[model samples]
Target: MASVSTIYTMGTFLSRAEGLGQRVRVLVEGNWITGTPLSCDGHGVILDSGAEGQFLVRVEAISAASYALPEATVPRPRPHEGSGDRVRDDADDRAYEGTYATVASLS
Candidate 1:
């Protein structure tokens, strides 16, 4: 049997978050916080919210964090030779599906 570890300690999360330039949505004490992660330590995390301001969110205040890859980073799939497939891989397909769903739902 293969065991999986889904639990992340605060220290573990901070260590993993270092140096990744991605936008993040953090849940803190009944409120949603959004920003780009700058740095994090045992005490807290620094988030840069463009045009708004940078925030020092304490570790204790954070309930959850979800990091999203910037739109510019996602590689746009080009049309393959003769196939009509819109995406190059499963990951791209999932991204496109979400975008298509959102656009469709608005109508």
Candidate 2:
């Protein structure tokens, strides 16, 4: 759902949205293109869409836009966290297994 809709150019909308929040929601790809506008000009704009990564879009292409202005609340945990799997850290394992000891002996 779009919070606000505007008929301004992408650059104009971005400049205005900066006061509210640089992060904007625009219907670029039907999949995922909502993110913070990294840079914009009269031609194209670069959007740093999280996960989806940054991409360029023509200013003229963007019409009405919206913002996912997150209310002041606790951030939600990412899906990768606590997925019943221990995150592997080779350095920690190496330290536990005393790889340093082997290296020290060689030195």
Candidate 3:
């Protein structure tokens, strides 16, 4: 199996590279996610959430685009009595926007 990396939004298009101007759909299964064109690398795709830190996804298969997002149900946040709304400071907000992806093949 070949490995491929990519960046994508929950319901938006996927970004192939830093500035490749290419977009595609993505499907994830368990710890393996696959997509077309297979980013320049063959490891994993970085998810673009306007957040920091790159997510490397190891691709297992690359055919028919058969994969689904992992089913994760986050519990509702408990309300705090006097906790001010959590807000990211200016610097923190800026740092959160940078994102990238790395793909690699195993075996």
Candidate 4:
């Protein structure tokens, strides 16, 4: 048998955009939270509601502190290449960092 871990995070809806290579829906604990394109940069996303905050999430069977919703849910910024891009990776890192930082700071 294989052992699995889960990850969790809490962050605000930064921003949502369309026309990206992928469209992913951000969810919290299996609950629909919001949707945003995967083209986000390191600056973090700007929510359409113009609100800034954080959210709490959990990842099942994963050790990662954070997890990306799914490619099918969130469209990729670039589809032609069929490979991950720097921008998307950076955005993910930023998102995780933001959440982790916020939690750490609070503690």
- Which candidate wins on lDDT? 1
Per-residue error (Å), model 2, residue 60: 1.2
lDDT of the candidates, in the order given: 0.63, 0.57, 0.38, 0.33
Q: Tally clashing residue pairs in candidate 4.
A: 24
Give per-residue CA lDDT, model 3, range 53-104, as digits (tens).
3334434332323232333343335547678866545665455442223233
Clashing residue pairs for model 1: none
Q: For candidate 1, report its TM-score.
A: 0.53
TM per candidate: 0.53, 0.47, 0.26, 0.20
| Candidate closer to the true structure by lDDT (higher is better), 3 or 4 | 3
lDDT by residue (tens digit), candidate 4, 1-107:
99997642322222223343322344333344333433333244322211334332332311222223442333335634746544456656445442311221111
Question: How should the candidates be ordered by TM-score, best one leading?
Answer: 1, 2, 3, 4
lDDT of 2 by residue, 1-107 (tens): 76986675667887666555568766543433466877777687677755556767776665556775542433334447668855655554454441111011100
Worst 10-residue lDDT window, candidate 3: 62-71
Local error of candidate 3 at residue 82 (angstroms): 3.1
Q: What is the lDDT, from 0 to 100, of the residue 15 in candidate 3?
A: 32
- Two-way TM-score contest, 1 vs 4, winner: 1
- Candidate 1's residue-wise lDDT over 1-107, tens digit each? 99987977654565466665667767776666666778887688877766567777787777777775444443465887779765466766566542310111100
| Off by more than 4 A, model 1 | 1-7, 69-107
**Backbone clashes counted, model 3:** 9
lDDT order, best first, reads 1, 2, 3, 4
